[model samples]
Target: MSTIKARALVLEEPGTQPVLAEVDVLDPGPGEVRIKIAASGVCGTDGHAIEGTHPLARWPIVLGHEGAGVVESVGEGVTGIGVGDHVVCALAVPCGTCRQCRRGLAEHCNSAARRQAMSGVMADGDSRLRYGGERAYPFFGVGTLAEYSTVRREQVIPIDPALPLDEFCLAGCGVITGYGAVMNVARVRPGDSVVVLGAGGVGANVIQAARAAGASTIVAVDAIPEKLELARTFGATHVVEASADVAKEIAAIEPDGADAVFEVVGKPELLTLCLSLTRVGGACVMVGIPPVGSKITFDAFTLTANRRLLGCRGGAVVPARDIERLVSLYRGGTLNLAGLIGRRIGLDDVFGALDALGKSTFARSVVVF
Candidate 1:
């Protein structure tokens, strides 16, 4: 097999910034393909991994997961994808044969294969990257922070090349997580009231999803006043300052509590607050990536009122199916993907964007190569 030398963001260790390094990208071994990255989204999870909080991340790893690219080559036993095909490298590709996958709950897949992939290895338990004369793993098996990425075929699904790859890339992580929290997990219905804590990237999508579902009221909460104004463009009916008596403010709009409450900030205290704002029989979904070893304490008594606390993983996305759905929505003008992108930056600007995660900002910052 041949090797391709590419410039990639390499994180040598946790609590350290990723540096640009030339890596030898190996040819796909089996059931794998190589991708030439076009655009990658800067996500809050990237910050978590950099802070040494992402449980699946280890040292000497590639630092990207939310991305879209074009297939460059296909390994043996690959089909339905070929060179020049535009695709989104899905972050939550489940092992279809796992027990959870078999049970139609692939989002909760806990099989060994899924675990291996999450830890940044392929089906064969090896990496395709070599940096500084040592093995380097992709972040979650589909690192897109580089000019090129080699990944298992299952991690990507082809999309129409006519659509802009930069915008569709957001669907890989933020859009899917936010939209699916309402549509899949909380099942927000028409005339329902929804509350989204943290009006960042994912929170904006939750607002959009609630709008699409015909919710009567979509309240967006955030500390950043700028993001609250930005959330209005994404379909938020009411914007509340995060520091206010949030529950009391929401109660004024929803006297019986909201039908769905989403905590997208990934703070343990917010999880407890989310449940408090959920109406009886409503759902409170945690859609953010909390740090490893963190604990959330909520009143167990809340469950007795028929309120549900759901932990959302990648919006419980079935990427192959959902990415297509998002594309269709984008085409029909129902999904406003273009408005979600706050900045289209270059790879050199990635650090600036990542640094702005908990601070003031946009719905998304995408690195366009």
Candidate 2:
């Protein structure tokens, strides 16, 4: 019920630069909730959007999707959730009327408002955030980078108050995207052999989710040794250093090839290498966001025999259901939620954190409010 001034990361033009600006935030409208963000996780997608690398990405947007926060107020008709609730924001805000949503595929809901989640505007087609008297779009609908955000009620999922806010913040994007790809989309079953390429934040979650699903031999492939070490703690049975002989090393472990391969790094060249490591009936899940205008060419015959390559968006997840499940697992120690966070910084430190991402400084740096 109040207007708050918050700092946000805004990209004004395509192929331009991102600037942190202090903007005015409006109150929640019908079916919306105003959230006071506790922490927002910086992600590769935000970076891609800023660089104009993502096809769905737009310009002059406020960047950030992965966030955890406390609900400050609820708009009319928003029930079962109240103020002071600690929740994780799901970028996929399902509109029950959409064709995709009616078929139980809410994650792919194609409603106009749902699509606007990336547009950073409320469902009413107007923005709640303004800078210099102009409206600005948020990277994803939630705009977690800001101190407060007004979003549809469907976007917020409540979790246990005891859960660490910074750690649970990851469930909004990195954790859910990676973990859901394995459990929901790829469905890595017991005793299956799996390979995870690029052991970053998303990749790390994939490795652990695969292990939790009972994958017998889990191999993590990364150029960084520290990431490989962290992967082990998160349930990677084997760590393979990136080398010219990566395929050879992996094949040596699973002679018939791996049952599942997750490409977290968007290099098409590495994707080709990942194909070679997949068994005849194996599935290769691509979750990485490559820089814009990049394409990968592959042999058609390789995928003809049931060896499939699938792109997992939002981990093909049902956020409300999946987020709660992840929180429970995290609390039970079955899922290593706390281990994924590399460091925590304030909102102003977002640019520096993202810049470090280009290098190999840490797994995932979180921005706290």
Tell me, by TM-score, which candidate is best.
1
> What lDDT does candidate 1 reach at residue 1?
48
Residues 1-369 of candidate 1 have per-residue lDDT tens digits of 478898888899998778988998999878999999999988888888888888889679888888898988889999899888999988777888978899998777877887677677987778999997889998978888999999989888899899899998888888998878888788889999999999998999999989998999999999999999998998999999998999899899898999899999999789888888889999889898887778988779999999998988888878888888888878888899888888999998888888887785688889999
The C-alpha TM-scores of every prediction are: 0.97, 0.95
| Candidate that would win on lDDT | 1
For 67-181, candidate 2 gives per-residue lDDT tens digits of: 9999999898899899999999987777778888889877677677677765666768887777777886666778888888887788889988878888888898999988888
Runs in model 2 deviating more than 4 A are: none
Whole-model Cα lDDT per candidate? 0.88, 0.84
> How far off is residue 266 in model 1, in Å?
0.3
- Clashing residue pair totals per candidate (backbone < 3 A): 0, 2
Clashing pairs in 1: none
Candidate 2: what lDDT?
Answer: 0.84
C-alpha RMSD of each candidate structure in angstroms: 1.2, 1.6
